[model samples]
Target: MASPALTPTTPATRDVVLVPPAIAMVWTGAGRPHEIVAVPGVVLGAGETLVAIELATVCGSDVHTVEGHRAAPAPLVLGHEYVGRVIEVADGVRAVDGAHVQVGDRVVWSIMASCRECDRCRRGLPQKCRAVLKYGHERIQTHWELTGGFATHAHLRAGTAIVRVGESLRAEVLAPAACGGATAWAALARADEVADVDGATVLILGAGLIGLSACAMATDRGATVVVADPDPARRALAVRFGAAQVADPRDVRALTAALAATGSPEYDIVLEASGSPRAVQAALEVVGVGGVVVLVGSVFPTEPLPVDPERLVRGLITIRGVHNYAPRDLDAAVRYLRDRGAARPFEELVSARYPLAQIDQALAAASAGRAVRVGVDPRDAHRRC
Candidate 1:
């Protein structure tokens, strides 16, 4: 679709800045290569802001959508995990910390925008607001064509929870916080409700970005974490991120042995970050009495899980599923990254980097699952970080 003519920027008194056309890799449909286009000038409305994307990480969901494993709106901008500089902010827009947003501030925002007045928001479930507008999920519409992170510029709409991050943190370290990190924080928050993380025995089912994050956060809280993954490299990486023990998920004996070594016969909290059906069932069976199973990675369709009512009654297991995180969880994700990012090799997670023109290669690298997270820099195609 051809974009409209570029709009002129108003004066500083009107709180507007001139923004150049943005280069965007637009996803037209499943199994098709993204079309690279130069997006024309963007004019921000009330409670809106425009950002120049510095770096973005290709998320698992983005890979799934492109591979036709999941359905997403066609011709949408397909990235929600990114870090960028604020190029423009309209009146009444504030960060999640309640600080006034300013130009040139490096920031990350929640993937979904929720109307705070909705019933879901009033009930403390703002992430699922009836009128939620998620970044990278909606179709390309006029005046909001730069809604996702696969572009040089992103137009953030009202009700999006923005958070200002420190300049000291690298963009690669912070981009994934928008989705992977924030969702991990929410999953851990759910487990905390039934079983406290401090000094508890926790088992993480996958060693992907989210699982590694949970492992680090749980370890930081004094919990003993055991991470299980089929990949030896990921299992080794888990130790660097604070896993007490790492095991192959397919080896039931190894998982059981790891749990026993933690001085707990069963996990006090089991976080299922692998979307495999087998992992979901294993989460139920391995959780201790009164323990909670927080499922975060089963976003794709799979066969119905067979649950035994007697198991729930006798084991007293609490099963909770977390989708996108709350506004507060996004804040927690940033804080976690800021405080502990340097100590752990957070930068190592984004192993491969590509320029905006190479988005096809980036997505392929992510889909191959060879790297923990694949990065995209939307600046000059030849620019190196």
Candidate 2:
């Protein structure tokens, strides 16, 4: 004899599952393999909400975390560059209600949550917020903070600075704005002090996301932008982005001579977006007296850059190191993209998109320079759906 199905009036015996669906990439140990795991029905915390991730980009930083080079714990959820829709909001979180955020509203949030009362936050530099914690940090325990955008759902805290994207912008296009685009905005803010973009000559090193963005902004600011990169394709892209000139770093001497013929030491500002030490050295060589050199890229296993002290002193050079972006920077990037006509045709920086199940392939494509931006669609059928 079989038991009858429980009716509304009868007592239930089955466990009430509480876990929410999440697609998480987990590393077992150092040099060990990683696996994507699915958790069903994870709980959302008070003053928090669950976001159904629409698109999550694989940033260079994400590669560092996955390779265990960042000293982060294993079996972690990866990804910080993302945009999504709010599915559930905790009680008392009123701002997100009906602002088109029910089940399917376009949105994006910052990577770190800063305590607004902190000294750094008070000073208008929330990136330096002392009490802040990143998404993948080992300290957070709750599913909301632990499982980041690489999953089906991301837990957003009460203080999370969320930006609502317009319906016109494509999720795949706006995804990079969360990190790569924001970083470029921060760099430009610092560069403006010395670059005097209205009429100044500027030299930009590398043609990656940051470099291309700088070129675009500088051109918009009326500066003559010169870009250098070894890759021909990137060099061509830089030219398309409005760079006044593009050259290969290997032919620095010839490029410098040609520029000098037009007018030597023409650059009033040198922006180094390449982490290579050689590029830094070349940047210092090309900048004029009283020029500014902004270091915007990160170099791993920090080593002493071979810089000429005498030249730096004699040239009255100003060297500034730029880190991650602040909230204001993100706002600026969004505004720039919005105002510049979101439909502007540009190269498809995203070369590929892999489902969360194929994270290994995605990571490899990102790290090998095969793709400028690789994305993971966490809600794909093969993911922990």
Per residue, candidate 2 scores C-alpha lDDT tens digits across 226-262 of 8888899988878877887888877678558545644
Against the reference, the lDDT scores of all candidates come to 0.86, 0.70
Q: Relative to the unseen true structure, what is the C-alpha lDDT of residue 289 in candidate 1, on a scale of 0 to 100?
A: 90
* lDDT of model 1 at position 15: 32
Give the alpha carbon lDDT tens digit for every residue of 1-385 in model 1: 1111111122222333334557778998877888876666765766778898999999999999888888888889889999999988887688999999999899999898777876788898978887777888888876668878888888887788899997999988899999999999999998898999999999999999999999999999999999999999999999999998989888777889999887877799999999889888888878889899999989999999899889888999899999989999999999989988788998999999989888888999999999999998888842421
TM-score of 2: 0.85
lDDT of candidate model 1 versus the reference: 0.86
Query: Which candidate achieves the best lDDT against the true structure?
Result: 1
TM-score per candidate: 0.94, 0.85
